[model samples]
Target: MKGQHVTITSEWTPREGERYVLGEGPRFVDGQPLIVDILSGRLIDSDSGRTLIQIDEPLGAVAPLTGRNGWIAAAGTGIALIDPDGVEWLAKPEVSADTPMRMNDGVADPMGRFWAGSMAYDNRPGAGSLYRVGVDRTVDRVLNDLTVPNGPAFSNDGSVMYLADSARGVIFRFDVDTTLGDLGPAVEWVRVEGGSPDGMCVDENDHLWSAVWGGSRIDRYAPDGTRTASVPVPVTQPTAVLITPDKRILVTSASFGFDQPQVDDGAVFVAETTVAAAPAARYGPSN
Candidate 1:
């Protein structure tokens, strides 16, 4: 399909309550919107502005665990399981402790394995890598040489994966072995024009929606890499994009780098849309 532009009015509404220093990872779990305050290491329920859990280090993203009580999260320098009792360390990737890196954007694939990426604190180029947590709880370094790795969003059937390297302004695609959690060669998918692509999600129509970190917009692209639509956001740093089941678009923004942040800079903003998202995947062996 050829690309077309769509308009979203100034009707974007920010969720009331607390603003985050770095708001990211907007997802729907059991029909409720959930987001993360990355810098503060908080997982929050977006609808009520309630803090679900708080970790000591940065919490990038989380996925509900199948047949389990809590969540599987990409936090700090590794992956961990967060439950009502407390946080249990899973596997920490072998990044040098002195280098100072943290986990970034991540999501559970359709086959229930979790994938996340890491980046250095100083934004050092070629100092980041992508990791995947298998169903057996083993961590594998999937890709290397990333700077600001933001996403590893998967397609509905888990046959295709899209990953974004924000500092490099590119998103790459990969073929996946869903049954075994193996990936094929990475192919350059999209080279973002105006802003760096941060977090992203795939919709029911097999279209990709990405949050433009410095461009103040959310971009929708067709499966063939054609830019289809753009949703203008009021905030400059739209960190992540989530499409709800009821066809509402949710965007998370960050206030971490601002000297004097705007009123809605760190808030979760929503707009009614006509496109719905694919069912979110959980992490675990049972699935």
Candidate 2:
């Protein structure tokens, strides 16, 4: 059932830091928010504005390794592991250089499998794909013929997955085979109307929260695919949303397409929310 509209304009305030050209992938790890400056390929601590690491290519997202002191990240053309030493490539797409695709949003599922999606630089239709990296470090193309794939958020028990095709303004739901990390059939879940969905996260109640790129808002959806609430954002482009463990909402924005950007256009914003989020799942063996 649809609920009353809740506008949250006064609660949001920008986090201290220099603005980002393309700020994205807000994830809470060890009680701190880690964000990515996508085009710059820099992963940063949102609170301190400290660069954790910067690579030569675009960095989409990262998840902490379960059994090691490092990170498994969706970067450039494939997935890589980052540590104090340096980055070691785990897998790369087989597509030729002429295709020119780069990784976008990604995360590790509750079962510790890493999944990432990629899109062509030119935004060509049907040129994007979603890949899954298993516990044994095998990369498999799970879905193809996508344009601007985002989110791919999962349910708490790893039984369901939700993915958005931003360019198509649609979010899809899928059943997951938890033991084998195989997806069942894709079902149309939500077709966004006003704004294209960007990045998303699932809350403790299994509700999905998405950052709407062009609508100046973040939307919350019930598990049954009903739009229940919407939180207004100060910036025009809210690239991603994270529900912090402390029950706060963290959003990353972008200044990429704006000619005269607002003061908070590319800033990270934080808000106090009633909902709580579980800690992100780590990549690798579960202890």
Candidate 3:
């Protein structure tokens, strides 16, 4: 059931062609909110509607996350750690530089492994894969031959992992082996008939809150994949969702493919939500 609207955070709009503000990653790390502007390489503060740092490099996903002093960013075909000095590539992607493939959405597991999904720039089928970065800094291609792989949110206990193939309009849950950082066979969790599921976040009660791209709304799902709640946003392309440390529900939107993008097309919003924050932020390596 849809609920009443709540107070929104400071409103901000994308400059231009800047879709999916949280397309890469948006999560609170150590009490600070971090958001990645995937196409522009803008590291936004998510508070003052300001850009804290901007790099020329384009990234598929940025884990508004860090192990200690640096961030884990999926650039081109590899994952890098960005800090005060510079960037360091921790793993090299398997595909060649010429491939039309690029990363999409990603997150860290409670065990501290970074998981990222990739897709073709032209939306070609079976041209993407999901990669896992171990704590030892090894990159492993776990899932292959996919299209538009989105969320990788985990259960509270880290026993289950929720993954999505948006082009199919479905999300899957997998049994996870936290010790080995491996994913078991996936079972259908939810099938969205209205809009493709994009990025997502897990709440305190083992429910999934996902952004419905092109649906102009966000939906909440139980562990068994049943719709429990929904919320409407001001944009048509709400790419991702997140909950800040202070308990405000924040959503990220995009402006891509819109003929004449409106003022709210690329805006990030705050809405009413009853769920608290997740058990803890995704794990990462120590300093």
Residues 1-287, model 2: lDDT tens digits? 12433233347889876999999988899888999999999999999999998999899999999978889999999999999999999988834645789999999999999999999988889899999999888999999999899988999899999999999999999999999998999999999988999999998889899999998998999899988988788888999999977888899999998889988989999887766888878999786
lDDT of each: 0.89, 0.90, 0.73
Candidate 3 deviant stretches above 4 angstroms: 1-24, 64-67, 94-98, 279-283
Candidate 3: worst-modelled 10 consecutive residues by lDDT: 3-12
Tens-digit lDDT track of model 3 for 1-287: 34222223343334333344344366776666666777777777665557765666666566544446566777666677777888888876734735666677778787778888888888788788889888777888899878888878888777899988889898989999979987899898899977889888887777788999989888888787878777767788888888655766878887777779877777767654445665234437645
Ranking by TM-score: 2, 1, 3
Between candidates 1 and 3, the one scoring higher on lDDT is 1
Report the Cα RMSD per candidate: 2.0, 2.0, 3.5
Which pairs clash inside model 2?
A: none
For candidate 1, write residues 1-287 as lDDT tens digits: 12443334347999998888999998899889899999899999999998999889899999999987799999999999999999888888844655889999899998989999998999899989989999889999989999999878888889999999999999999999988888899899999988999999998888899999999998998888988888788999999999888788899999988999999989999887766886568999873
How far residue 130's Cα lies from its native spot in candidate 3, in Å, is 0.5
Q: Give the top-scoring candidate (lDDT).
A: 2
Please give the lDDT score for candidate 2: 0.90
Clashes of 1: 0
